[model samples]
Target: MNNSLKTIAFISGIVILAYGVYTLFKPETQISIGDVDLIETQDNTNSYITIAVGIVIVALSSIIGKK
Candidate 1:
């Protein structure tokens, strides 16, 4: 049970980290109309939240695995 939990934590961390990176790195969508440029960007809050969650999960997994 302990090992399984650790594995889950590690996997979840990696997935979340990837999502965070994608969210942070994705380019804004831009639309140009008659010399007007409109750009839509991702919310910075969600990326930070995922990054924090990912780090926490990875840390917990390592601590658990060491036991």
Candidate 2:
């Protein structure tokens, strides 16, 4: 049971990490804040940072399990 739970958790972490990577590569839709147009460009630096954080999270979860 514990192993199954761990596997599920690991898979979930990987999915989340993949999503973050996709968001990093994918172009963000433009948004308008009042009269100013806010465009989100693909920021590799930020993306990598996010990915790193996600990895850390996954690593911690794998070590500690869930909470």
Please write out the lDDT profile of model 1 over residues 1-67, one tens digit for every residue: 9899999989999999889989998888899999999988667899999999999999989999674
Give the count of colliding residue pairs in each prediction. Answer: 0, 0
lDDT of candidate 2 over 16-53, digit per residue (tens): 78877987878677999899998866558876876787
Identify the runs in model 2 with alpha carbons over 4 angstroms from their true place: 28-53, 64-67
lDDT of each: 0.90, 0.76
Give the least accurate 10-residue stretch of model 1, judged by summed lDDT: 38-47
| Candidate 2 accuracy as lDDT | 0.76
Local error of candidate 2 at residue 48 (angstroms) = 5.9
Best by lDDT: 1
